[model samples]
Target chain A: MNDDEPLIRWQWIADHTAELADYTGIHLRLGLLPVLFGLIISVPLGILCHRWRWLYPPVLTVSNIMYSVPSLALFMIFVRYTGLTEQTVMIPLTLYTLSVLVPNVVDGLASVPEPVRLAATAMGFGAVRRVIQVELPIAVPVVIAGVRVAAVSSISLVAVGQLIGQGGLGYYITRGLQLDFPTPILTAIVLIMLLALATDALLVLAQRLLTPWSRNKVTSA
Target chain B: MIRFDAVSKNYPNGTTAVDELSLELAEGGITVLVGPSGCGKTTTLRMINRMVEPTAGTVSLRGRDIREVNAPELRRGIGYVIQHAGLFPHRTVLDNIATVPMLLGWNKKKARTRAAELLELVGLPAEMAKRYPNQLSGGQQQRVGVARALCADPPVLLMDEPFSAVDPIVRAELQAEFIRLQKELHKTIVFVTHDIDEAIKLGDNIAVFRTGGKLAQFDTPERLLAHPADDFVADFVGQDRGIRRLSFVNAAELPLRDGPVLPATAPVAQARAADEPWVLVVDEGRRPLGWASVAELADGGTLADASLTPLGHTFSLVGDSARAALDSALLSPARLAVGVDAEGAVVGVADACELSAGTTAVQAAAGEQASTEAESASSESRATVGKTSADTPGGGDR
Candidate 1:
């Protein structure tokens, strides 16, 4: 079939199995590493920022600015300095992830009931022990929920990396556009959406596994 | 013993939370710190365990300054309870109670075993040990909080409005349970509350604080009620201070009259021949049934008839306070308080009029004793002054 003759071009897709595998691997890493990095960096920073309290607004403002910057512009701008390597793509994606995850982390930690924290202190729990044993465990559901959003959004943003020639799934859409065919574009969009949905589902499953208690309505004791 | 020696907490915002509060809390008794909101009662209680640091002076527990001990170590040794129980939601009730024991490095099995014992001690069933805090009622959670505090068997307990969050009925039940526990445990406790009645009911020594954080009066509940330090204390104690003072008086001292009492199976003629118009009817076991009227017997009413007036209530002179006896007299249909023994058998009775007279006599006797003691104190001071003058040549210059 000619590139533009049949609408789907299924034969072309089957012949490009190796390319699909390569692109899928790249897409998965591009989407997930930022989330992993974001969580590692943001959670501790969020906890520290929460403790300082005065540091929170400034950190949030900087993150919000980073997140609000267009992904294409951030990637292109970093390309000038980092010379179009994976770092150019990964850095902006990680920044966006941090913006979303940090607030959620802070809010999750803050959501712990004051009385519960007071009780921990009154019961002789030191600051470190209380945070680790009581606060973090209680904050898990909210923190995991934030991660789900970051993962899904980061998956979509990975497609934006195509503007700087590092797009994983979006590489197909770019080629399809260059060739003026609709099949590759449709396939890429479907695959990206599926990846986002799958990642979100995994996060939700992790939340359920981690926090069985939060599922029930907590009556005041 | 916990002693606060001129301890003051002056906030950076220029508000004095606690101002030079000097007080000594006797060992093995409950000392209540109570006042209006923002009066620093809570701060004072917190200072006992170094939760709130004093700005001016020292707070020593058992002769050691609390600041010298590691905070967590000091706190583990001093049990703390607050309003709303403050239980850890993630933990089961057993684990919540086992917190201190676990902190003290007890094995899981031992901590849980002690936790189960405390669950029962606070009047909870053993089955509730596995349940979470939210699964329990507010009152039950408060009980668990108490049990958790007592788990380490700390000699000192600091309770910040512990029962205030529960309903009135539950609060009373918890208060009664608290009193019963204190009777058995005899832990030295410092309780903070806003309710004057709670302080009066639970405190062996009540320290009433003014709004500005000054100690208005520090005295025993009875003495505080009978003789407030100033108008601030008098008003704080409220207009019912006289009635509250009755709780401190002993009902056993009241004169008892064996008013006409008849057996439940007594004949109508025998009831009619009784001296009093109203006759107390007793069962075969000598347990009081109700008050019967001689007039009813005279009107051809048999003892089996249902013309008997119900006994409002009865008081045990052996264990009851004068206030309880007065309450009994006021509640009775015949205006008489029935006195009963441990076996529920009728002993003697007192009318409301007689109780009031007895209370007055008791007060007069107390006043006489107080005056003689004051005169002796003054004379002894005078003798000391005279001795000083005789011994020291500098006294002549003075």
Candidate 2:
């Protein structure tokens, strides 16, 4: 708390390069694994909701309710079952992803043009084949847009997991606050922001590679 | 070949899409089902491929019940084209065309090769194979739709307003290409459209449906125009159908006369001596130059020296229809349709009155033959069945 203390100390960073690298790796895993699991669960759930019209509203409401539970309280609730581990932090983060991922998944599938869907059916595509080949491919751009939002938020939310002992780079953020050292907090915030931006850029690149045909705006005839 | 035996499609909400319809579509010909919106022409067409299942009765394909086959398997055997092209936006033009072939279990290499060939067949350049559907024009997208449908070369093809989405000029061009393709392919096609003109132009047999899913008439386009089955059909065919029927009669059949035709070298006094109000001046090779008013002949000069009114247009005796002759006659400054030979030399001329008489004679003869056929096949439905024969030449020159 000294007024003359520098906001950032260069020596602390140079000395903690190995520790920073380890935390960065841990941060990415904690942030990304949930998104990966969310996608796996959401896609099938979304397809089921799309196939049955009534399922979506209830599913969306429940996921939104789950999302509204404060992340810290969600972490604490999971703590009793899984104990003070990465599982406690990750369990809540995974559930948080459902609110964003499910709607995007539903909206992505809905984005397919009706005519294209009919054409696929007429061309002899079976239900599963059409969903996999035609509908899902067309839904990619919209789904990836959802993924970008989910990914960035997921990465940043990992910092809040610092309340539990399993917070990745969040440990430094809390450490800086407790000791009244500003350097680790600044470095962690900058690193977290950089991770979010880099993940978003990668998702954009993935969307570009996945859907080359969508590059041009479609003109309805 | 496809047959619908008392097929009735009635929805739970009391909408009768198709009612007690019994139709036999001829193989290797285009059978157009045309009517106004809500007339169930589309519903009837879709029932063939089971896109819409019939609530009652049976739809048999080539003597086998279609319900015996799985829906997806049945669809794979029938080609379908729709308005807006409905091409997959995620796939390239070649890949879109290759879809059915790939679904049929053809190797990727073989499927793509067939797709490339179809791209050429549909009159698209090979380079367009790699481009997406959105990158192309509306007309181009339609061509790709047709190419995609034909890739599997199924014996039966169903089209639901395929060309209705394009501009008029492009629609006309696509129509011409479609007729040309039909001649070579001869796949049994069921085309659904609200356009009566398109039905008359492309159909080997036109099935005109009334508002309540009733088949008003199913007959050759010429017969449909000349002898509409009822008031609904007569009105549906349009009041100008008498003029439209002229499209069926060949222009060569019109009786032409050499009246008032004079060589340009004839003296002005000789031109003045012509009985007609205008003298049609001709060049040395007998090609029509222009119409010269007999009263406007100058003093002491040849007919060539007289100021002549331009000839509006001429109908070709070899290829044009009676409609073209009538159009020419109506538009000409001289009120005479000049008929020309293959070399563009003036053969003869006919006024609109003469052209109508000529077309009437052809229609009377055709009507008599149609009536005789109808009488022999006493049942109205029997008379309409499988008459998709040589009459398709109606669109040959168009």
Candidate 3:
């Protein structure tokens, strides 16, 4: 097979439509699970850091280390520890993202205007109630922005799960390189790129839906 | 009844906002805390509801210690209005006002109903309830702030520079609305402002605070204006205090001789008062129709035929401060302002000479002129207290 043959890849993709569906289902599950986990862990952690300033430097340092850890090295480190299993891959990807996500969540919330918070307190909102009612609502736009970035990042990272036993699009690329058949590999690359674009578009729609007030402000400005 | 007993606040940086200040806010009247900035006027007001906790002493509400109660719970029970209205931008006007009630777990329906009722009570229509804070004019937003504070019907209301955000015109309207509301609700209020005139206008008792959180003087507006505690209080209240006093006198309060009911056939000898140069002419019902000089009376002119510009009934109602009365007198064309009863009948006329002297002193002081004008006006008015100095054209209260 020709190394750069587009028609061969198109044929392979058409033949493997069912596999593509399964891949989509898997990619979606992998992408969303980590985000849901990150949101839960990071929102509370961010709030903790917000209430106590001393916690910020340490939390920021941990997040920065996670962010700077090369994805491929993280993959190898987890694989070496857990022996190339799917769970090993998923866990590291989720843990690695906490760095980017925790900071975003914290920064998203830290930016809520001082006057708005003051007004909330003056209105008799206790600490937790202020978090839920005022801070969360005001931080929605920035929080959603963080989620968008994290979701797209997770989708691209989870594709690397093919390095182990998981048969994701990353598996197809590895398969083609092993067998010297360019069709499966190029098919995987195109499909993954399309998935990334589609997921990003979906997140943008979600952001718009959740923050109409922000939308009005942006357009009016 | 709000009482501050030796209340003092020291910030974490060790700045003393209010230093051991004690004062009693009356049960159903407006007590104004007037001072320069950093005098702790605002800090004193905030301590009443525990927004700023007192570092040294207790602030009591109706004799109950604020410290003994839960701070948030106590705050929910006290209405707080701050400068710029401090409205929550994310919430609608109705939601903003309903904050305390919702915190107390009132059913949504009841809270919304209360918010709507309060919006109407503050002279805003119920339609304004759905708009957000950014959508409102400054004055409307401040009214909503007041409405929100009053939503829970807290017996003691604390307002800190509540009207400072609005222009003068709306401020006046809001002041009038506040006075009207106080008359009806009888809620005890502690108002803080740097504007001395606002304190004079709204306060039953005005407390003048000097810097370092020391209260210079506390007294009724009449006494405070008539006799300031020291040079500081006097300067702070402004130098034109005598003009501040004429507001106490009404046009009808001064002795007015009855006008002649001289019809076309009336006799000249019995028609006009001989002691007066100009006799007021009126119809039989004692309604002043016009003025006829003694020269016209010599021509046998009837009261109906006199040159009467409507006596421009200027009157000071009970409870209006000297400032408000001076303002009213200044606005009237008639130097002799008429004080009317609530029924609008002429109660009495203010002495034109006194009102002018009072107004001149205010103008002189307000203009930052030296005491020269005030001294001259005082002595000039003292010389003519018994005589109507009407010929000193255009100098009364205005």
List fnat per candidate, in order: 0.48, 0.61, 0.25
Which DockQ values do the candidates obtain, in the order shown?
0.47, 0.56, 0.22
lDDT (10s digit) by residue, model 1, range B1-398: 78778789999999999888777777888989898999999999889888889999999988899999999889999999999898887788999999999999999999999999999999999888877787789999999999999999999999999999988999999999999999999999999999999999999878788887787776667667777767778898999888887776688888888888888778787787776788899989889999886765654545666377889899887888778889999998888899888899988899888988887788778756754664565433221111222122122111
* Clash pairs for candidate 1: none
The reply for model 3, stretches above 4 Å from the true place, is: A1-4, A7-9, A80-83, A165-167, A176-221, B245-398
Q: Which pairs, if any, clash in model 2?
A: none
Please identify model 1 stretches exceeding 4 Å from their true place.
A1-25, A81-85, A179-184, A218-221, B293-301, B360-398
Query: Residue-wise lDDT of candidate 2 within A26-49, one digit each (tens)?
Result: 999999999998888899999999
lDDT, candidate 3, B1-398, per-residue tens: 67677778888998888877766666778888898988989888778777788899888787799889887788788788877787766678899889889988999999999989999999987777777777778888889889988998988888888999789999999999999999999998889999998998799778888888887777666667766767788899997766665554433333332323333334556555455554444444444454455555445544555454444444445544344544544554444444445554444445556656655555445434423444465433221111222113111101
Give each model's clash number.
0, 0, 17
Query: By summed lDDT, which 10 consecutive residues of candidate 1 chain B come out lowest?
Result: B389-398
lDDT string for model 3 (A1-221, tens) is 55465546466678889987887777777766777788888889988988897998998898778778876777787777887766666676677668767777778778777756765676677889999888877677677778877877887787677766553667777888887888777777777778778877987898777654453222110
lDDT of 3 at B240: 74
lDDT of 2: 0.89
